[model samples]
Target: MRFSGESGNVTSGIPFGLASALSQAGSVLVAAPVMLDGADLISATFVRSLAGSLSLLLTVVLSTERKAQIRSMPMPIARQVFSSAVIGTGLGMTLQLYAPSGGPVGVVSALTATTPLVILPLIWFFGKAHPPGLAWVGAICAVAGVALIVNAG
Candidate 1:
């Protein structure tokens, strides 16, 4: 998730931060029309899935380096991706599609956003990788960010 400047210095923050922003935006974009106009959730999800699949296909087809890397991906990594697709994209989105735009749903939605924060400690406590302190700080901040968005009004 690191990016490089013209000087090739790594600029971190692409993994969680970028993906979180995009996920929030994508949900709003998809949810708005569905909530307002009574659009079909299955159709919306299917279209989003098709577009995402096409984008990935294009990335793999267009970039030899990316294709090579994906081709060489280990079984464990592939399994992780498969599970994520099933749980995160499939089941999660199906549930989210039924959620209202506001009320208690927002709180529940925000709490789910804290999964990484919760996972970080479990991973550390289990003797896995000793993640950087800043990573924990970032996860904490992300969890706290829910306060900023939730409105009692």
Candidate 2:
């Protein structure tokens, strides 16, 4: 698969798509246990942050170029990392706290599928990139599918 425009080219989607799906599955696995155990959101977030920090540390230690790469990364990329940490880790986990204990994990996971809907507009307005009409259609369809799953759950 390929997508081309001002953002350049995406020659393949399979690897990233699979990685995203697996990451979501792992999140649900971790979250369901914590919710079932009645763990506080703060503690859950702390544990997650700690784990992420350790993983970062391990990667930096193992990769000689990692520290330099981070140091030289552009401000926009750094800002994105910060935003993702705040939104994906902090806000997202906080929302999961409201999930009913032992309720279907699918509901919470499905909610995450709305990210494209949120991202599409952000890219258009903030990033000033115009996605093709098909991209909008796909994003809308994704949100609709997620909504259906949420309603069913």
- lDDT scores in order: 0.66, 0.73
Q: Which ranges in model 2 have alpha carbons more than 4 Å from their true place? A: 1-13, 50-69, 74-80, 100-103
Q: Ten consecutive residues with minimal summed lDDT in candidate 2?
A: 1-10
- Writing each residue's lDDT as its tens digit, candidate 2 over 42-105 gives 8877776666667668868887777888889999999999898888778776666556463677
Candidate topping lDDT? 2
Over all chains combined, what TM-score does candidate 2 have? 0.69
- Give residue 115's lDDT in candidate 1 (0 to 100): 60
